[model samples]
Target: MTTAALGPNRTSRLAARRGRQRRWHRNRQPIGLLYVAPFAVLFAMFLVWPTIYGFYLSFTDRNLAGASAPSFVGLANYLEAFADQVVWRSMGNTVWFTVLTTIPLVILPLVVALLVNLNLRGQWFWRLAIFMPFLLASTVVSQIFTWLFNPDLGLINAALGSIGMTGPAWLQDPKTAMTAVVIATVWWTIGFNFLLFLAALQNIPAQIYEAASVDGASAWRQVFLITLPLIRRTVLLVVALQVLASIKVFDQIYQMTGGGPANSTRAILMYVYDTGFSNYRLGYASAISYIFFVIVVVLSLVQVRFFSRKADR
Candidate 1:
């Protein structure tokens, strides 16, 4: 064939190959989409739909019974939420709970995990014992703690009495109720974070510690310089998880405190429940929920920013 003719033939073959590849790509697209369709459907139905619906509901004046007609009052519910003293009280309570719980949950678990990782007797038993609380249902744990915090027959007060200490009426008194609830929450949930830290600790290579030892570094110095810096990612993860979880804490406060003793322990979730169900103000409840969501998002962003800065350093 002539050189020009040969070039045209080669170009034609190349075009045909490209056309085949394009057809194959088009054919694969549907199968890939089909594989993901279930998750897409679920997300739309559960997460996306509810989120959109909740936002819509927040703008209207809907009642719990659905008997009254809803009137669209743009931002009125939100305004009411801000003006309402109970909402602020609930927000304050949630912030207090988050601060009270997050610190202990993040720090105590790390300390316990460190202790467990060291040479100890019956290490696996200690680990299992430490983690046993996480296996129980939240409601179940709350109920058990509820009885334990009971004023009259609770073993906790009895133990304190034996030790010459007058135990306060834990669940009944507002001052003690919130504190007791926080302590129970910390105990019940700390195990999971502890295990996470423990796993991160184990994944650190022993060679690093040996190298530190050869450099004549003390144990505490090794921890501060080597172990802590290396596990910074996991520590950040634990802190983020605890902070978020603590902010949204509901079940323990619900079951144990009932946001009771003059609503001193009423969290944002409890306020939402009271507004929607108890007072039959669905719109107000929805508005408060969105506000709470915003607060959570802002706090999460702060955590992320701090985490990023630490990582950069």
Candidate 2:
């Protein structure tokens, strides 16, 4: 055929293919919507509506016990939050806890994962032993640690006493209270990060290590050059997750210390709870929570951007 005649036939075929795609998409649109409808409805009802309602409540004086309706207070709640020294103190405590826990949470689990990945005897037992703590409920973990850290009667103090050393009250004193909580949190949650790292490590191709071995690379060298570089993405994910989890720490502190020793361990979430439920200042609590929500969102965005740039490079 001549070039001009062939061009028209190709154009018609392309137009027909486009028409079929459009018709197929139209036919499947209802089914696709049906698949997503349940999740969409739940998200709107539970997440979206509550978020909007909470934001609205932040601008009002919604006393829990008051018989009257919530009164519009504009920025009064926010202004009060800024001036509240307790709020600032609680925020500082939360930041300190995050700093204290982030290092161990990110690093120790990696070590455990590496150890478990070794071709050792009874590897399954080691994996199960390390990960069992993570399967326990937060309350159960707290209770276990509570007994272990009891000032005079605790096993920790008893162990110290045998060596002529006195152990400081772990959960009672302000200096050691947060440290104790951090220890318990690390023990309880490191399993999760361990599992994440183990999965990532296992996904690494065995042939890469074999190639390194053929090149006379030692085990340690292979880990540094081949394994670590490949799992950089997983490491970043674990760090980000640990940071966010540390920031929102509440259950352990609440169950263990109750923000005691003059509110030294009062995390931001605990402060919010006290304000909303204990003090019956729902509006003020909402303002504080919204402020925290913004901080978390900003931190998450920063982490995402940092990882994206690292990945691109």
Off by over 4 Å in 2: 1-23
- Tens-place lDDT per residue, model 2, 96-203, is 999999899888989888888877789889888889999999999999999999999999999999999999999999999999999999999988999999999999
Q: How do the residues 165-268 of candidate 1 rate in per-residue lDDT, one tens digit apiece?
A: 99999989988889999989988998999999999999999888899899999999988898888899999998888878888888989988789889889999
Cα lDDT computed for each candidate against the true fold: 0.90, 0.93
Error of 2 at 113 (Å): 1.0
Best by lDDT: 2
TM-score of 2: 0.91
What range of 10 consecutive residues in model 2 has the weakest lDDT sum?
26-35
Overlapping backbone residue pairs in candidate 2 total 0
Candidate 2 residue pairs in clash (backbone atoms < 3 Å)? none
Rate residue 189 of model 1 by lDDT.
91
Task: List candidate 1 segments past 4 Å from native.
Answer: 1-27
Find the number of clashing residue pairs for candidate 1.
0
